[model samples]
Target: DPRSRDENGLAPIVWKREKMIPYVPTPIVYGGYLFDWSDEGIVNCVDLKTGKDVWVKRLSEGGKYSGSLLCIDGKIYGVEEGGTVTVIEAGPEFKELGTADLGDASYSTPAVANGRLYLRTFSRLKCLPAKKS
Candidate 1:
């Protein structure tokens, strides 16, 4: 069901899926593509023009992914519930950049602002400095 509504109470159906994970999936639009993450921590690249899935990759294991995926500097960031952050290249090819241990547990979505990445764990909030030259 579309959620957008204007004065006329109508919304355009941009895309629809037959089956989706039972978790919050945030779709990031970048470079003419839509990047989506499943609840089980699978990353998928879809063509924004046609909504066709171009590729998919499993990002993490052992725990479900509850945080929304973040795309920065041509890389995808997925944080699992067990506090593992997996970074991968943003494209059809699955290229891993790095993985960092946040040392905590969380299910909240992450946010990127002012070039810094913010993550909320079960006990505290962590601020990761933006990549520097």
Candidate 2:
């Protein structure tokens, strides 16, 4: 698998220079999975150790994915260009929990503080409280 290689082996697998990822958003690693967002608006979940693709899901409308991923309480978040935030369960299966829109444009990652999620768009900012179980 792609995850069990040496440091030098990571170069060719972890990142494919030949392909165009197109986005600069940071990726998150947790629970043995690496969550990444591509400029094509695709959310990719890969095995952290082997670099194998566990699953892939398109976040929203295609293009302009600049939000970093956030994982909290076994859930993950992906923000799309049009301010639509997608919440998903953190697992090997592609399960989207929900989606909420904030504005017309969102290029930054959502922030979590004091159990609240802070989202920003080209025109506004919103804070959503964490849902109680």
Candidate 3:
């Protein structure tokens, strides 16, 4: 009820989807798509307009993920709790570009700024500078 105050007066939900989307580590949106993954490393790409899945792919065998996914430069970067980074092409098709192990556990989402990527793990922070063109 929009007329009253408090929790009982909140606006009604416009729509709801039956599909399961990740609740932890927040999802990211890009190019008319919503990108999210489960803690077990099942990545889901959903079309924002029709609330349909574009593609779903398993990123890892059974690695628990704590950090959120990051999208940059036409790519999606997801880090597992074990510190392995999976890079996927951001598009309708599920294409894994590559993967790298950070050699530690990561609990924080990655950050990009000034042509560099910053990642934080349980023990330390790692920075990767952008390659020169």
Which candidate ranks first by lDDT, i.e. highest?
A: 3
State model 2's lDDT. Answer: 0.76
Worst 10 residues of 2 by lDDT: 11-20
Model 1 TM-score (2 dp): 0.80
Better of 1 and 3 by TM-score: 3
- The C-alpha lDDT values of all candidates are 0.78, 0.76, 0.81
TM-score attained by model 2? 0.77
Tens-digit lDDT track of model 2 for 1-133 = 4448676665345543234344587877778887777777777888876666888777645556778878888898878887777788888888888887675788888889998888888888888786664
lDDT of 3 by residue, 1-133 (tens): 4354557767655345666666586878889888877777888888977667888888854588878888888898888888898888888898989899899998778899999889888999999974456
Best by TM-score: 3
Candidates in order, TM-scores: namely 0.80, 0.77, 0.83
Q: lDDT winner between 1 and 3, please give it.
A: 3
* Model 1 Cα lDDT, one tens digit per residue, 1-133: 4587778887976876665543675777778887888888777788876788888777645358877878888987878888888888887676778888889988877788998889889998999876875
Error of 1 at 116 (Å): 2.0
- Cα displacement (angstroms), candidate 1, residue 46, comes to 0.6
The lDDT-based order of candidates, best leading, equals: 3, 1, 2
